[model samples]
Target: MIIRHFSSLFIAVLVISVGCEKTDRDRFNPLDPLNTTTGGRPQGLQAVAGHERVLLSWADLAIDAVTSYRLRRQDNGGNETIVDLAERPLSATFIDSTVVNGQTYTYRLSVLIQESEGGVIQESPASVPVEVTPGPNICWIADEGLTQILTMTSDIRAVDRQITSIFGAKHLAVDPRNGAAWTTTQFGGADGAVAVRFSSKGVIDRTVTGFTFPASVVVDPRDGAIWIADIGATVGEESSVSRFNQNGGLLFKITGFSEPSGLAVNPNTGACWVADRGNNTLHLIGDDGTILLNINGPGQPTAVSVDPTTGDAWGINVATQQVFKIRSDGTISLSVSGFIQPVRLACSALDGSCWVVDAGGGQVIRLRASTPDGYHIGQQSDFHLSLTDFFVPVDVSIDQISGQVWIVDRGDGSVVKIAANGSIIRRFVGLALPVALTVDAGPR
Candidate 1:
């Protein structure tokens, strides 16, 4: 009887022990790495902006006895950046503070199943990349440049310059920040050479050289790189684009231009619109020098302009005395005719106005455009902007800000600054056989 009683006691002990083991298995720690697949994975990760902060949130995230969750971001190069939070399979959010204007950032959503002692729980494969770009108020100058010159490209000038260089200098571009003026010597340039930087006082601050027959020059606002088109092939050689830092340090030289004459760089698109006069065409080059499209025309096209707002290209043909409206698909159309060697041009983003310089007849013309290349003064898009006749208007430029016009008259050796309606606002006489004219909006 005593032996039977001892066996019964042992059986009871075994039963209790087995029950305890089952309980432990059923309640596994949710945070344990093996427990990560407890209820599947996180879903619907979205990025939301909250007053300078980015909030990364997810839905239906499963958690049990976990310590924390880990979040990460993925860059365009496929690198991972992180954000972390504590505890629970519950849905969660992460607030990101490292965001600013003019910057593009990408992120990936992930869940971290926290480990017991140290180190983080294993993260799920990065969620599809989510992006949020913060916006800031930008002080952008309305590029009402040569359009005003085109409207009045021909009129009342001795040296009839193109609108962009309507004054006495080959106004290359305007410093986007402070609107300082830049230009080059037109007649004989060896390379990516910058002849002068006109201060607010109209004084030369710097001169840059060391390029190959530079034609059009532009400064990048993002990295502030100076890009100049080298027309070396014009004299029987290959052509290229010379890139330099803002301070004049040479960066790189890009080849494959055929008599490239004019260029306009869109800061927004990072695309360069180059006028390849060799084939009477316009080549839209990427920021990295890739040609997006090659738009051809009926004549030798020289001047190029880009509408940053609409992403359109305007090719004004000097040889054919016509303007070609170029679509992004490499399509071209004759927007207007009867241009007398329209050498330079500009467009106003403000009122959709346009200007052109006719060096052939010493005239400055204007066309009020509703769209980038779609403009008409009455039925004729080509209207003589000048009330008086020009002897030789070589180049042209216009001031959209002040509604003033600046022109270089080669015949009179003078630079004329006029009001919007062809009235002489101010005249600079005896400034050489003035070759070009551009408005310096910075100078009051």
Candidate 2:
């Protein structure tokens, strides 16, 4: 009888131990008001303000214990509201389109978890509030010497945000449709010829490799496709132009070029104009990888730009110090000389005018199109800046909304904003080798 009593006691102890073990079915009590929170708060909460909208995103929760999220938004006037998210599997990003532009908003996020079989809930602590202001215009600047990308305010008086750690960031292009930016890294890192895409919130969205030496990149304003010019490993060896989707997927790659240094996409038709410096040729390639027109004899055309107002493409031959306007039908309508080392040209959509940056001349010259190919150079009313204003001006872009020319002076390490009437609006100084600048004035 004593032995039977001992066995009963041992069985009772085993049952108690098994009951004490935690099981997967055990729910966390998130509603406990004793300040002991179970689930952790959302991390890396970032808010990007846009035109009448704000995008909020956070890192994924480390565990699968979260059942829902509670996002709280507060405006500048102390008005608070909880965003209604009804999806079961919550997304990491939320776009609040009900926001108004120019108004500041603050946001906080928390996690909610089921704590019991009866649907009792527990809430994680709210994240720190993030504040942002929406604006219509922003400028993206790429500094190769500093290896950084900077976003400047609409007025060009202050920097809105800066993203560092980019290696050999030579050039950048912004997509006005989504506010994302794409750039090519020319040096350093294991992946030397790499291209990176940054999201609207300044986060690395995607990185595409396998380029030999990407010289320039541009976005198709019509369809948001990305075009890259890989100058190849060596001159006249494996040079190519590739097209990528907005998500960084390779759509198509057009090969057989000799150092395609400059790429310009036709804003209306999504076609690409490839300037091959090594072969001294200008190629007009269709979006479907077909060579529509190949014109030889532009004297090493290194840079090209298209005017959306007219389908004509303008190219600059650095070796010849000349600019050529190529008509849409594969014919050179006009070839103008007398430029002192014209490195880049940007055609304005506002008036079909082209702004040329002459590094040797140290001037930004504006040329208005009279015909399809001709810019009236001998005309007395041409807009020309004095050479004293710029030193080694490498790139030029136009603000379509305001028709102001933005010039990147690499030697002076500054970006100059000039009004259409030949007045300096703002001179953004103290940059480290600013190589490229693109203006984003919302959607056209």
Candidate 3:
């Protein structure tokens, strides 16, 4: 009987010991690295703005535990995209290039961890949201007849900010230093002719008077001085070239031009080149209103332009259907003929080539700096743009930012925008007269 009692005690001890072992195994924590739970959320999430991109960065929670990271981005329009970055946990940096300018974006970051046995993923909570806005690309155009300046997108969409109260606004020049625009007006009466300055936001910053008929205006990019081609009351009564400070104070006036139509400043040398239609000559004037050189043209020179890259000046003769290229030293390098009453000319600062408007031919011609025929004088045009739908194309301007050409057709009162590939992008109509048009790269 004693032996049977001892055996029962041993069996009871074995049962108790086995129960305690099972309890310990059931209390194991699943949050351990060998299990399924992940590390803490990523910290220090950041989104930096760029031209058309956003850079994302974050701090890693546990480098050894994390197998990868996930990034989430959302735009202002509520569009969301999730990206999985495998095997990139430490020093995590990502660039989102599929973004547009002038847009805002939000971002979030999280880390992924794997279980030691099953390789299952467990993601931590995302970091706090970050936001950024990219820089926008825009352009501006001036309408002389309507006395308004229109701001446009890269694709020709008009913005809400239209500059008004500019009376008889003729030609416009945008300062490269600041995006400010300068123009000449003939609207104020006998003393109405003035040079006006407009800020980038379409506000009139200042106005300088004492001009009889301010036909053309330009700003010296080097010193920010204002230059005006003041065509006097009578044909040769008071015609002069005037210079003014950034404020409305007159610096000096050089009189001699009998009908100055257009003017351009040499960015390299700071010299002002004017086209005098009355004398059929192109005059190169120094910054102090002193005549430096006189270049005689084939006929009446109506418009002038200077290539900033090479400091070469180009002028168009309306009476002789010719284009004159003057070197930086005031010597005539080459004079090409074949145009039909070219009214205006402009040279690309980025490239040495030029564009001229032909009113008689109803077309625009593009000329290269060097001719393939090896002749420096009187070479044929590289290409001619004759849009069948356009008539009486008088003035032309190029947007350096977009590399697009804009033409003012006086016959239809329309503005035609052409792409760099010679494709007609859009034709803006409903304008009255539209005698002159100038473009400004509104903001970067």
What residue runs in model 2 are displaced by over 4 Å at the alpha carbon? 1-135, 235-237, 371-388
lDDT tens readout by residue for model 1, 1-444 = 999999999999999999977654543543233343443335566775322456676664445434455677654566667766763445477778776532446776556554465765566555556665432211111112222122111222122222334222344565655545555543323433344454433345666775445567776656666677877786676798766666667767777778778877776777778787887777777776576887665478788776555666666776757766665566764377655567777665555455676777677776555433443423453443543466667666555454555666677655665566657744545444445444434322
**Can you give the lDDT of residue 171 in candidate 1?**
44
Which consecutive 10 residues in model 1 have the weakest lDDT in total?
136-145
lDDT of 2: 0.79
Instruction: Report the CA-based lDDT of candidate 3 relative to the real structure.
Output: 0.72
lDDT of 2 by residue, 347-390 (tens): 88778877888898888777767633434343434433343488
Model 2: lDDT of residue 183: 89
Mark the regions of model 1 whose C-alpha exceeds 4 Å error after superposition. 1-171, 179-181, 185-208, 221-223, 371-387, 421-424
Error of 2 at 26 (Å): 63
Q: Mark the regions of model 3 whose C-alpha exceeds 4 Å error after superposition.
A: 1-99, 102-139, 189-191, 233-236, 372-389
List pairs with backbone clashes in candidate 2. Answer: 30-122, 31-122
- The model with the greater TM-score, 1 or 3, is 3
TM-score of each: 0.54, 0.68, 0.65
Instruction: Provide the RMSD of all predictions against the true structure, rounded to 1 decimal.
Output: 24.2, 14.8, 16.9
